[model samples]
Target chain A: MQGGVIALVAEAAGAEALGAARGLDGNAFVVTDLQIAYLALGRIGPVVTSARVLGTGPDGRAGAVVELRDAGAGDRLMTVVNVSGVPAAVLAGSTR
Target chain B: MTSDHPVDRRTHVSDYFRLERWELPSDGGDERPSSFGGRAPIDDHQRGAGGGLRTGGLLTNLDTLGGFTSGLAALPRWIVTTSLLATVSELDHVGPLRFRADVVRRGRSSVVTALDVVDEGAADRHVAAATMTCAILDPRAMVLDFARPFSLAMPPPQADPVRPEEFFCIEPGAGPVTRLRLADQLRNPWGILHGGAVAMLADEAACRAAAAHGADASGPNGLAAADAVLHYLRPVKVGPVEARCQVLGTRAGRTSVRVAIHDVGAEDRMVTLGSVTVLAV
Candidate 1:
């Protein structure tokens, strides 16, 4: 789950972060770590995940932490820390 | 003069013990073979002595989940479990390893079984549990061509290890640590380190670190992960990690420890944190 989130957030963050960021297809996030603290059991549709981009680096590695929640109730479910590496080739999706 | 079966004095005790210990001697003959290639041969005695050593004791049955979890801390625990289970029953793996087998109930095929592995240590601190169902398989039992073989190399010792250490140790002068590089092969179908890589990474670090923690110069050490549930907090890029394993303690035959996979950088963030327990086999 963390790996998928890393790919999601890295690609999303890269696409959303300004400068030499953003994933090539908005799907190439390479996760390095995922620290999760379970808050509640998610038992509904479309779990909402909000990722806070930590930062990027010159070494192709990146980091972020995402909070998962129940989409309808907005109750926090799980927190995941994500890390990824952005390749230089796909570094142009972000206009923010 | 050549035989897979060996026998000797200890064999004699066991043979004699078998004569008195239990009515069932695996050998149907009145006398157990006393040496390898039974010709009343002398060379067979030395080798067969080791055979006698093998028949000493049976492992005690674990009764509670806590003790069951504790018993699993030793790798050999499941060897007896799986062997006995496989000898009599069948298993089906639903996920990577969550398995279901029939446990013994009241009648025909009376046993059923299911097991789940949580790699991370449970908050309850139990590592894992493998449940088994037992019932007599009739001569008329229809054999089901069950599942895939779950074979694995036992985790190596704390000294010189055979596994690849994926997490790198980049410290300039901090003694010896395992170095694992993520260059070409680590990439997934998507050209990045795969999620599976993290487990491989965790395995390499945990087993090797166990060896380094418990093994000595003689090297015949055995300390492998009793329990490990991984949470990929971040993805490892093309760089290396300095795998650090801090020994917490060793009790009975188990070793409890903590591990942090860290990259040598400014943030110095720990990519993975694990509480693992290993026991000598």
Candidate 2:
């Protein structure tokens, strides 16, 4: 579940970043990597994640870091994730 | 906790963990290329006083299994672990955890492997889900030659392996600093200290640093490392690697720490950067 959340955050952030680039022709970004450190368990209702783009590589890969906090748990840090993504078309055997 | 388990003292981390690899079906091409599956025991050596597999132990398992899967995906070209991420949902685990690894992506310069672990003794309860990213590089002459559908036999367990702290010879230094010797037993196939070893050191450093920051072990909020994210920028080919930890801050009983691992023998160059979170257990 945490992994899926991370990928969703990474893909959303990467799409926004890649959407700004001119030459790519609207390609969807796929999460390439995600490194996460689980801090505490989320014993609350909703877990929120905020992401900041670390940087974008020359080869169209974008890196970002995400932090997940449990809102019901006094916004305590739940996990920290480092994620990267590349255009779906760039993946091997991708028809896109 | 007593180290009563007789230490066999293996040379390599893989041997110490008794990681055994088995072949996976070559279905699901790029997305799920049934890469590698294996299993290892989580005995007293790998467990903490809390009776759960330590955070470092969990990271080590992720690193080891993911490394093999990604390395094999890279084939003739070797690979180096650039990043490792794992979220462990379950803490108390039964012995002999099983691992399933698959290729998520095989790109031009990198390979990403996704791994899932389950407790074999606990009726295959989910233990962790992790991903490893490796930078594909020219192997030169250090390429691994393995037959198709490669399988490695589990080394006979003579006795319980030494704990990571003892195996790595980790000792506390001044303040939040921890020292790890780059002994041959800690090195990987590339003749460098394994990434798992680095993660273990970082985890240890984070816990110690949190303790230094008033995270009382006997307090209402006892501290232990819950999660760690490591980015391997360079390899440690020299000895006396130091993990210098700095407490980022504490929030709601959780402390964040940044650890910079440097190879003192290599002119104190930073080899890995780690972010660890210590939580009240």
Candidate 3:
């Protein structure tokens, strides 16, 4: 797989989690950091991803961690930690 | 019976390694012309209408050449890449690329190799530098599990196939997401996807994300990758891996991006993580 593609996949996972944790409504977000560590090779089928919020910044941004795993055998593939900033509007919405 | 020519058998070490050269293209010349005899250009799509070499392609070439160079020193043993770090200063139309690899440390089980790609015209200036850590595994002691659990289903053949591109291509997916599929050609001899391919994917995603955030607004020179670090967590064996990217921040015309690659089937698992910095040209 290409590194860009992998990054996109990982970013998508993080974005999804960030959306769930804080309803963005219509605010924009920017990524600050992304770190990935590979665990195993996926030789069977499609890989799945999930993410969790690590923390939130005072400015409404958040840090998230995402994981990729084998879909068939459920083997872990990679882990990603992403830090992103959410607009203040989205943060206000979450507080409500 | 000896001829007038005297053989200097001083053990020419350089001959043991393969030498490859890239000739600089003339002004307005095609940087990457079609290799398949007049077929469509191989890098047209990757150029993104800018007509410059993609950063991902450059990294892939660096990784492949570095691996080949390391293999010469690892003789009788296989070298597996554990990690790689690359930094690029410029990647415009500059060419006539040249690279040489040097073994930094040779241990019993692992070796560290440093490779530098430079422009032939300016020998002192480096276009990109990469360091790779490889583990030496005894070939005789290697175990082959041919019966490993691999999917038997194959991807449908391309409708109009031409020569394969050197770097992996990306397709836009749902907002800020990109997708790629694994093919046999992209796999290493061990039947797993090559690590270089993974690096290319990560670099591409990071660059695109940076570009999306107006990182390329500094004239038409385009964004150049300043540095990148890749951590390989596992082997990618499946199809349709997706990549997501986020722009961490920007300062002084440089943008930082964080990217994650995940298996599409398992939306919760990650396959790789990367951090890249791009400077506006």
Candidate 4:
């Protein structure tokens, strides 16, 4: 459950970062990739995620790396993820 | 092949994937650094319930090509993968996927590679993005020899190599634990358990643990693996590798799991750490 939540939050944060970087609405983007490294177990509740835009592809694809922490556990590091968001229209003809 | 390590006499995990290597030109016309890639057709046995290549199988291919790319960058020395991470955006891909990998950073002790897979049959649409990190190490007694612009072809077909689970003969040991013995065919060029084998073992352990923990309560549909993040801390040099898993939690038909792989013959030292997510089908 936490893994799914972490993925969702990272995607949202990555979309926002990319939207801000490219001057586009965040809602126009969708997460396309996510690669995470689990550093420590998060035993506490209310996990938080932070994102930083790395670069934007010429085709409007944006990449970012996100870090997740446990807010209830003294903000201890939990996971580091590399995520990418692309224009939602790109999936128009996708089979999956 | 070294007398102590007869890796060449046996088939490798890469042979099953059937990836055809290609010679790549220098990046940006620079001669010092270069990129390499290959292509492979998606096979029926490799598909999951979602009609796409399974994450574990895909990761195996990624590890193969990415390892070669990084190894080339660290010539005169060798590398053992430390971690592997990837996300597949498009699962239902057309045939013949192209894989490209290039060195991201080449340090004295570590090398990182950026890996990308695109559907060649779908106008090169993005399919997956991944990264591999390897620790640089001296090849001590091992020999290092390769023809520059290195290229290799898929080994001759061998009566249809079975799926990984079949090849490894994975069997459930006890609650939330799975075991597989180290067979010669399961070793990599380094004479160690192939990284892909490690991934398959971890994936199986997570699936079994998640299901036992109620992830399969959804009905006969059962659970399917969604993603995997593996950190290979050390190589397994001994036999009878074991994977122990624990379900962290489940919600909305999604289960999160953690797995620890240990070399049972090597004093039970942990060899790899993995986290997996499974979705109810």
| Reference-based TM-score of each model | 0.31, 0.70, 0.53, 0.74
Instruction: Estimate, for each residue in B1-281, the C-alpha lDDT of model 2 and write its tens digit.
Output: 13556433222576666788887857766444557888888767777644567777778767877887787777778788998776554556776888888776677898777677778898886666666789998888774767867787876674756677887678855469999977766777777888889988987888888888776466453566755678899999987999999998764444778999999999999999878877666
Q: Write the per-residue lDDT of candidate 4 for residues A1-96, one digit (tens) a residue.
A: 267777777778888877877777888777755786555567885888887665554556567667778889888766667776677665445421
Which ten contiguous residues of candidate 3 chain A have the minimum total lDDT? A87-96
**lDDT (10s digit) by residue, model 1, range A6-80:** 345434543333223443443444332233333344565356656544344333434443445667555634333
lDDT, model 2, position B52 = 67
- The local distance difference test score of each candidate is 0.32, 0.71, 0.53, 0.74
- Candidate with more favorable, higher DockQ: 3 or 4: 4
Clashing pairs in 2: B11-B185
Which rank order by lDDT, best down to worst?
4, 2, 3, 1
**Comparison by lDDT, 2 against 4, better one:** 4
| Candidate 2 residue lDDT tens string, A3-94 | 56645654565455544442453356666445655555667747777765544434455555566777888887666565555666555463
Off by over 4 Å in 3: A1-96, B1-52, B121-124, B138-167, B173-175, B214-216, B221-224, B265-268
- Model 1, CA-based lDDT: 0.32
Choose 1 or 4, whichever is better by DockQ.
Answer: 4
C-alpha lDDT of residue B197 in model 3: 70
Q: How displaced is residue B147 in candidate 2, in Å?
A: 2.3
DockQ of each: 0.01, 0.06, 0.02, 0.09
TM-score of candidate 4's A chain against the true A chain: 0.81
* Most accurate candidate by DockQ: 4
